[model samples]
Target: MARDLEFGDFTPAEKRRITALTARMVLPRANLTRLRRQVEDIEQQAERRKKK
Candidate 1:
């Protein structure tokens, strides 16, 4: 089963700082469409329980 995400674990200021840093560090260089495709592939493989 997929683990639940815990956004509540971070304080507001920490969350804001993380958000800003992630935007600056990750968003500019991220390939979102390719990431989406990789996620879909993983989901499909998990559904089928295909071993790597």
Candidate 2:
């Protein structure tokens, strides 16, 4: 089954790759904003779980 991704799931190199890809995109600004928000949400969720 497919699973949701958490921020901690990505390695530092992977995170850099994601950022690079996101930055090189020619998509609409709203779409890029949404992607950033999604990443923030994933990180937040991971942080909450880690605190438990």
Candidate 3:
């Protein structure tokens, strides 16, 4: 079975890499505002979890 991984499980470097890849997922001409909003949402969740 595949292991379930959470965002917090990654090292700082890995997290950065993940963010870079996520951004590149959109086409060069695609709408970026939507993607940025989604990424920000996930980041906020990570921050909230860290505070708990």
Candidate 4:
């Protein structure tokens, strides 16, 4: 049998565990900067291609 489990139904530890598992990971500063630069480069390339 499948039962729905609400967030409130979890104990404090269970809630914390669930929250930690589901949280988004923080990217490192260097990686974030590299990703931003790559995105900007892609956008510039798209603009150049659109002008052609």
Candidate 5:
């Protein structure tokens, strides 16, 4: 069986709280993966700008 996920709109304070909580819950491996992805994205953008 599949379940549908519910999404809600968050106020600025609520958004900040949720982000802080999530950051606390993130594992080191997951954090490393996120940093690698961000670095790759930045590098790709730099390469594109260089080609322009």
Candidate 6:
């Protein structure tokens, strides 16, 4: 089953795990800059949502 994510609810370690997993999925199709930007964007958006 799938669980909804609350980025603010995660610890730093959990956040890093999420980021690493996402990078793994993205690596095959993306260059380093693209991968970095995608991860940064994900983190930034999640942070914005969490503040709401």
- Scored by lDDT, the top model is 6
For candidate 5, the 10 contiguous residues with the lowest summed lDDT are 1-10
lDDT digits (tens) for residues 1-52 of candidate 1: 1133245544466456546554654577887666555544444445444333
Report residue 25 deviation for candidate 6 (angstroms): 8.3
Overall local distance difference test of candidate 3: 0.61
lDDT of 6 by residue, 1-52 (tens): 0144566655686578667856676566657766566666666656656668
RMSD of each: 9.9, 8.0, 9.2, 17.8, 14.9, 8.8
lDDT of 2 by residue, 1-52 (tens): 0155554666576567557656755655547666666666655555555556
Which regions of candidate 5 fall more than 4 Å away from where they truly are?
A: 1-30
Candidate 5: Cα lDDT at 34: 58
- Model 5, 1-52: lDDT tens digits are 0122112333355445545545755665567655555544544544454456
Q: What lDDT does model 2 reach?
A: 0.58
lDDT of 4 by residue, 1-52 (tens): 0133344544566445444433422533335555445544544544454456
Q: For every model shown, what is its TM-score relative to the native structure?
A: 0.41, 0.45, 0.51, 0.42, 0.42, 0.45
| Candidate with better TM-score, 1 vs 6 | 6
What is the lDDT for 25 in model 2?
55
What is the clash tally of candidate 2?
0
Q: What lDDT does candidate 3 reach at residue 31?
A: 62
Residue 46 error, candidate 3, Å: 0.4
Stretches of candidate 1 off by over 4 Å are 1-26, 50-52
lDDT at 49 for candidate 2?
Answer: 56
Best by TM-score: 3
Worst ten in a row by lDDT for model 2: 1-10
